[model samples]
Target chain A: MTRFALTVEFDGRPFMGWQRQSHGPSVQQALEDAVHAVTGERTAVHAAGRTDAGVHGLAMRAHVDIAKAIAPFRLMEAINARVRPAPVAVLDCVEVAPDWHARFSCIRRSYEYRIVNRRAPLTHEAGLAWQVPQPLDEAGMADAAARLVGRHDFTTFRSAHCQADSPVRTLDLLSVERVRDRLFIRAAARSFLHHQVRSMVGCLALVGMGRWSPDDVEVALHARDRAQLGLNAPSDGLFFVRADYPDEG
Target chain B: MTRFALTVEFDGRPFMGWQRQSHGPSVQQALEDAVHAVTGERTAVHAAGRTDAGVHGLAMRAHVDIAKAIAPFRLMEAINARVRPAPVAVLDCVEVAPDWHARFSCIRRSYEYRIVNRRAPLTHEAGLAWQVPQPLDEAGMADAAARLVGRHDFTTFRSAHCQADSPVRTLDLLSVERVRDRLFIRAAARSFLHHQVRSMVGCLALVGMGRWSPDDVEVALHARDRAQLGLNAPSDGLFFVRADYPDEG
Candidate 1:
């Protein structure tokens, strides 16, 4: 048996997040089916992060184990060829150490949220980005975002469905910048609580719209109550940017 | 009657082209229908450029005459509301002089062609960009593109079915730049013949891939023969960026 690491990119509009589900299609089921078609094995596929529905993946890290004796390149090609019509592609594939895990061995993960600040309705970026009709004060949003960058109890920013045992996580980076009419919020950390990025982005947007202040964010963080949460941004603008492993640069 | 000029943006994948067609849906038809639904006037919509099938528009300039007296803001909102699920939007609108024509009064028009230089299949940018599997040397493509800048007889690049009275047109700018794995080709001119930008990009792609030299591009331009053209790129990546009028700035 050999373990192969795969770098996958997908459009999340059609899938029910990254995990397998009985009610709807998912990225994991599609990849697993493709692997079955290629190798005749029902090998399980594990990803570094399980994204929510309508969340895009730019370079998601994943790993799959197969007992079939096949080259990495051939397996990648065969799987890609079999995954027809699905909006998923394997960008890179390589053999990895048996002990390396896609989820546990990963050290860091990065995500980006896109917001198109405009009054007119979106055309090219309809589903790809979240459109905010009001003009945003990006500098204000940046100021408010800094208050949430350090270690704190993120209970107010987590979803009710979050299953993580701990409410505290170290946030390495949280930045907000505006380019023309588009606003980008980038976040990086070892891991994140469920809906943490979206919830943080929602409060930052309120700041951008002049509904909240920097101190409000810090106050909310200290409250540690989900009822005190400002808002939970939609899943349309969320993207899993990449996952960083210690072995690979 | 009041003449209103509109800055439009659309995803061109669903429509046959910008012009009205009997066989397939067109952007012009959608706009005209929306105007009729809003103002009860079956007016014609004229555009600065008639893009080919599968070509997108970023900020295409167009105009329509409405007999009803309505505020520009209200008219824009009404039209936007009426054009549902069409992948088209009016970014801006304003009243214009009766003599100001969308097609005739335009001083310059700009276009952008996107090429994703990679071997992996596209997911998010499926119909938004052209995927070139081979590696491209953008510097070489830029050098070849420079040869096409300036006034010249471009019969070699004009389409066989082009209706322009003459093959002579001044190309104001042609530039190629690579940002990461994406290549951007920008072109601007007062007007263009059919298939001119795509034809130029196709030949430049050959230069980037080492199949043709810069001299070959110049030789083809001088040949003044349609058969001498190297290739014509697909319409998927072409975008009508914007149209410039003298009085706007």
Candidate 2:
């Protein structure tokens, strides 16, 4: 058997997130089915991050084991041919060492949240952005986001049903910037709790609208209480941007 | 009575085109109906350009006449509220002189065509961009585009059913630039013949793929026959970006 790593890009609007679920179709199921169609093996595919429904991915990494020895580019083409009409694309595939686990071997993951701040309803960015009718103060959002960077127990910013063993995670970067009518919040870390990025964006949104202050974000982090946090931002704007590996030179 | 000039944006996936048509819904009809719903007057709305079906608009200028004396911003809000669920937006509205016409008063119009030059099927940009699986040499496309600049009888590039009286329109600018996975072809002119931009893009695409030389473009233009040109590019990638008006400032 040969182990292969693939980079994927998908619009997560139609599926039920990344994991294989008995309830509905998913990115994982789609990939697995495509692999079966290509190589006649029902190989399991594992991704670096299991993104939620309505999220998007620019470059997601995954690994799967197959019996056939095929060229990486050919495998990419065959899998893409099988996953047709679905909003998923296998961008690139490469032969990898057997020990490279997509989930565990990843060193870093990055996500981006897009918000279109304008009075008019979004047309082109309908499902791709979180629309805020009122203009947002991006500088204020950035100021609030700065308070959440570095190592901290992000309990208040995590999902209530988060299954992580601990709430402490080191946030490498958190940035907020405005471009034209869109406000982008980009965050990077080794790993994240369920709904952490969305939760943090929701709190920063309140700060952007003057409903909350930078001090309030610090207070929420100190509280370490889920109830102290703002609402979870919708999954529409979130994107799994990239996953980094140690040997990715 | 007050005349309002509005800048509009829309996703043209559902509509027939920019003009009102009896067969199906149109962007013009939607906006006119929305205006009528708000002002209780059936008003005729005129746009700077009549984009084809499945094309998008980043900033389209239009003019509407209403007898009611209403604030421009409030009028925009009311019309937007009335046009519920349509992927159309009124970005800005201002009261203009009654003599101001959306089409006749425009000095220049700009358009952009986006092609995602990649092998994978598009996910986030599924409906918004044309997916070209083959790699395109952007520099080659730009060099070919330069040959089409300036005043020339563009009979080979004009649509066979073009309604324009003359084929001698001067192209102010035509540029091809690459930004990440997207290839943007921006064009500006005082006006265009029907299908002119799409036809030009289609021909340049051949140059981008190294199938046609820059000299071929000049030869095709000199031929002055529509049959000598390439096929019209897909409507999905074309966007009516903006209209220039001297009086707006």
Candidate 3:
């Protein structure tokens, strides 16, 4: 058996998220079915991050074990062809060591949240971005983002369905930048709890709109209660940017 | 009575183009319907450029005449609210002079063509960009583009169905730039023949792929026959970027 690593990109508008679900279609099911069609093996596809519904993936990493003797390039092309009509693409594929894991062996993961700060209704970016009609003070949002870039018990920002053992995680980066009416918030960490990125972005948006202060973000972090959370941004704008492994170079 | 100039944006996936059609919906019809709903007036909306089906509009300039006594901001807001679910938006609106025209009074029109040079099938950009699987030499395309930047009879590039009286047009700018896997071809002119931009991009793409040399573009131009056209690209990648009007800024 050969373990192959795959880089995937998908539009999250139609699926129920990255994981397999009984109720709705998912990215995982699409990839697994494509693999089955190509090699006649029902191999399981494991991804570095299991993104939520309506959350896009630019270059999410994943892995699958196949016993068939197929080349990486040919397998990639077959999967891309079979995954058709669905808005998913296997961007890159390569053989990897069997011991390597897509989720556990990952070193870091990064996400980006896109906000179109405009009053007019969205045209081309309707489902691709979050539309905030009010004017945003990006500097204020940046200041608030700075307060959340460290190790903390982020119970207030996590989802109640989180399966992680601990609420403590170290955030490597949290930064906000605005170009014209578009705002982008970027976050990076070794791992994130359920809904952590969206929850943090929601409170920072309130700060950008003058509804919350930077100190208020810090206060919420210390509160450690889900009820104190300011907001939970919608899943439309969140994107799983990339995952980094140790031997990426 | 007042003449209002509107800066419009739209996704062209659903419409038959900018002009009102008998069979399918159009951006003009959407704006006109919204205006009638808000003011009970059957106003005609004239656009600076009549884009073909599947061609998007970023900041299309259009004008409408309304007899209702309404503020420009209120009209804009109401029209935006009523034009819901159509993927069209009035980005800006203001009162203009009686003689001002969206089409006749326009000084310059600019367009952008997006090409994604990759082997994988597109995910998020499925209908938004044209995908070229082969590698492209953008510099070669740029060299070919430079040869078409002057006044000449552009019969080879004009579509046979074009309604323009003359085939002669002076292209002000035609440049190619590549950023990673995305290649953008930007064209600006006082005016253009129907399908001229798409035809030029098609031939330039041929040049980029080494099928046609830079001198071949000059040969095709001098041929002065539509049969000399190498290709006519799909309408999916064409975008009506903006129109420049000569007036007090």
Candidate 4:
């Protein structure tokens, strides 16, 4: 079997998540089914980030093993052609080493969370961004975000159903930037404890609203308890931006 | 009566255009009906650009006169609240002079056309951008576009069904810029003939595709005939970006 690496982009509105579920459709099932239709092989496609429902992906990295002797471009074309009219598209595809796994081999993962700071209700950006009606102090949010940048036991951020064995992880970067009336939160790390990004963003929003001081964020991280979580931001604002691997730039 | 100016944004996928249509919904009709519901007055909303079907608006300037004793912010909030569930948002509103007509008093108009140069089918940006699978020579297109600037009788670019009395118009700016795999064509002028921007962009695309030479563009422009037009691009990628008036920057 030959392992093929693929870069995929998708709009996550109609998806149940990256993982297949009995209740609804998923990105993995969509691609796997497309692959089966094209090459007659029932294979599982693994992604670097298993995004939740209502979350988008710009360039989610993944890998699949196929026994068919197909060219990389031909496989990508077949998958893209069969995946529609689903909102999944294979952006790039290439052959990779057999040991290179999609999830386990990923070195860094990045996500971007968008917030539209405005009074008017969302029009074009309804499901694409989180809308905050009240004014947000972006500088304060940035200050609060700085406290969660380094290594820590992020127990307060992990979801209850997270299957990760360890709560300790090093966060490489967490930045809050104000672009006009929009606030963008960019997070990067080797790995995260499930809802870590959303949980941290939610607390920073509290700082933006003056509800929680910057000191409160550090205190919550030190507490390391899920009960201290202020809020879990909705999945609509989050996007799995990209995943970095060792062989790739 | 108070003349209020509004900065509107909308996703034009669901409407027949900005003007009121007897067969389908329009942005103007939605806002007018919302105004009637709020103020109990039959009003007409005039916009700077009356776009074609399936075209979007980022910050289209518009005006409406209402005889109600209401503040600008309250009127804006009421209209936004009532126009709910529609892909239209009143981004900003302020009182203007009675003579400040939306269309007649406009000094400059700007439009942007987006082209996604990619082989894969669109997923996240289906209706938002026009996807061309072929490679585009953006620099060549820019060189061809520079030939269209300044005063000219743009008869070859106008649509056959255009209602303009005169085809002579001054194009202040036309620039083609390539950002990664996306091509953005921005155009600004005091005004434009019907289907002028789309027609120019379609020919520019031909130049980018190597089908037409840069000199061919100049020859077509000098032809001064509609039959010489190569193509009229789809309205899906066109956006009425902004409208400038004398009183406001």
Candidate 5:
């Protein structure tokens, strides 16, 4: 069997997230089915991150094992053909060692959340951004977001049902900036717990609107309780931007 | 009656066009209906430009007359509330003199066309951009676009059914630039014939792809014949960005 690593991009609006579920279609299921259709082998596909429903991916990494030996480009073409009409595409494909795993071998992951701060309703970016009718103080949001960076027990920012063994995670980056009428929050880490990024954005949004202060975020982080967290931001604004693998370069 | 000028935004994917028609809902119809719902007065709304189906707008200018003297902010809020789930919004409203026509009084109009040049199926920007699965030489495209700037007879790029009395028009600007994998083509003019911007982009895309040279654009412009034009690019990627009025500021 040969292992192939693929970079994928998808609109998560229609799927039930990246992982396979019994209820509806998933990005994993769609890709696995496409692989089966192309190679006639039932192979499982693993993603670097399992994003939630309504989230988007600019560059997601995945790995699949198959019995047939085919060129990476040919595999991409065949799989894309089978996955017709779905808003998913393989951006790049590369042959990798058989032991490489998409999820386990990943070293870093990055996400971006977008908020359009304007009085008008979103038209072109309707489902792709979080719309805040009132103006947001981006500098204030940045100040609040800065408090979450570095190593911390992010329990307040994590989902109640997150299955991670520990709440402590090292956040490599947390930044907020304004471009035109949009506020962008970028976060990067080795990994994340369920709803961690969204929860953090939600808190920062409150700070942006003058409802919360920088000290509030610090207190919430120290509280180490999910109830202390702000409202979770909608999944629509979140985008899984990239996954980094060691030894790739 | 008081005359009001409104600045609007919309995602035109579901609408027939900017003009009202029996085939499907139009942006004009939606605005007029919302106005009537809010004020109980039927008013004729006239826009500066008529965009095709699937074309979005950022700041379209329109004028309407209403019997009641309503505050601009309240009128904006009321109309937006009554628009009813449509992908349309009245961004701003201002009182104008009765003779200030939306179409005739406009001094300049600007448009932006987006093309995502990459070998991947679009996910987040499906309907908002034209997806071309190939690498485009942006420098070549920019060079070719410069040839179309300034006053000229645009018959080669004008639609066959365009009703403009003369094909001659002064193009204030036509610029092509690349940001990552996305190509932005911005055009400015006092007025344009049907399909003018799209036709220009279609030809520039050819230059970007190495299918044509910069001189070819000059030759096509001089041809001044519709038959000499490139294919009309899809309307989905075009945006009616803004319209300028002299006295608005």
Candidate 6:
């Protein structure tokens, strides 16, 4: 058996999410079916992160083992071809160590949230970005984001369905920048709890809109209660950019 | 009577173009209907440029004259509200002089073409950009673009159905730049023949792909024959960025 690592990019608009579900289609089911069609074997695929519905992926890392010996180029091309008419694409594929784990071997993960601060309704960016009709103060949002960095109990920012054992996680970076009418919030960490990034961004957005003070972020983090959350931003604006592995160069 | 100059933005994937069509929907029709709904008066609206189908607008300039007495803010808000569910928006509205015109008063027009130079198929940017799988040489494309940035008889770069009265046009600027895996071609001029921007970008793409030399662009321009055209790019990647009027700050 040969193990291959795949970098994937998907629209995330049509499926239930990355994980396969009994009720609906998903990115995982799409890839597993395509692998079955090409290799005549049903194989399980694991990803570094299981994104939510309506969340986009610029490059999510995954791995699968196949019994049939095939060239990496041919395997990648065949899988991409078989997944036609779907918004998912396998960007890069390569042979990896048999023991390498896509879920466990990951070191870092990063995400970005996109917001269009404009009064006009979205057209091209309707589903791709969050449209906040009110103006947002980027400086104020940045100040508020500074309070969320470093190790802390992020219970207020995690989803009730999250399966992590503890709420304590290290946030390496969280920065906000404004370009004209657009606001981008970038967050990086060793790992994140489910819905953590979106939940933090939601409260920061209220601060940017002047509805909440910067101190409120610190207070909410101390409360560690889900009810203290200002809001949970929609899934449309979140994107999983990439995953980093150690042992390069 | 009041004449209001409005700035518009739209995603052009759904309509047949900007002008009213007999058999299909158009941006003009959308705006006209929205106006009639709000003011109960049918009015003709004129735009600075009538973009073709699948061509997006960032801030298209237009004007409409209404006999009803209405505030500029109310008029803009009502029209935007009534145009719901459509991918159109009114960015700004102001009362212009009685003789002000959207088309005749325009002094300069600028456009941008986006090309994603990558091997993977687009997902989030499916309709917003053009995907070119081959590697593109940015410097080569830039060198070729410089050749077409002056006064010339651009017969080879025009559409056969274009209704321009003269083939002679003075192009003020044309520059190509590569930002990572993307290429942006910007063009500005007092006016342009139909298909002019797309035709030039098509040839530049060939130069970047090494199929044609840089000097071939100059030769094609000198030939002044439409038969010498290398290609006419699709309407998916083109965008009408802005129009310059002398009276604006």
lDDT of 3 by residue, B103-208 (tens): 9999899999999998998888887899999999999999999999999899999999999999999999999999999999999998999999999999999999
The deviation in Å at residue B231 for candidate 1 is 1.7
C-alpha lDDT of all candidate models, in order:
0.93, 0.92, 0.95, 0.93, 0.91, 0.92
Colliding residue pairs in candidate 6: none
TM-score of predicted chain B, candidate 2: 0.98
The CAPRI classification for model 2 reads as: high
DockQ of each: 0.76, 0.89, 0.90, 0.82, 0.72, 0.74
Q: Give lDDT tens digits, candidate 6, residues B1-249.
A: 999999999999998999999989899999999999999999988999999999999989999999999999899989999887779899999999989999999998899999999877787788778899889998999999999999999999999998999999999989998898889999999999999999999999999889988899999999999999998988889999999999887
- Top of the candidates by TM-score: 3
Tens digit of per-residue lDDT, candidate 3, span A1-249: 999999999999999999999999999999999999999999899999999999999999999999999999999999999999889999899999999999999999999999999889998888889999889999999999999999999999999999999999999999999998899999999999999999999999999999999999999999999999999999999999999999987
So what's the TM-score on candidate 5? 0.97
Give the CAPRI class of candidate 4.
high
DockQ of 5: 0.72
For residue B89, give model 4's deviation from the true position in Å.
0.3
Highest DockQ against the true fold, candidate: 3
Give the per-residue lDDT of model 1 (tens digit) for B175-209.
99899999999999999999999999999999988
All candidates' TM-scores?
0.98, 0.98, 0.99, 0.98, 0.97, 0.97
Model 5, position B186: C-alpha lDDT score: 99
After superposition, candidate 4 runs with Cα above 4 Å error: none
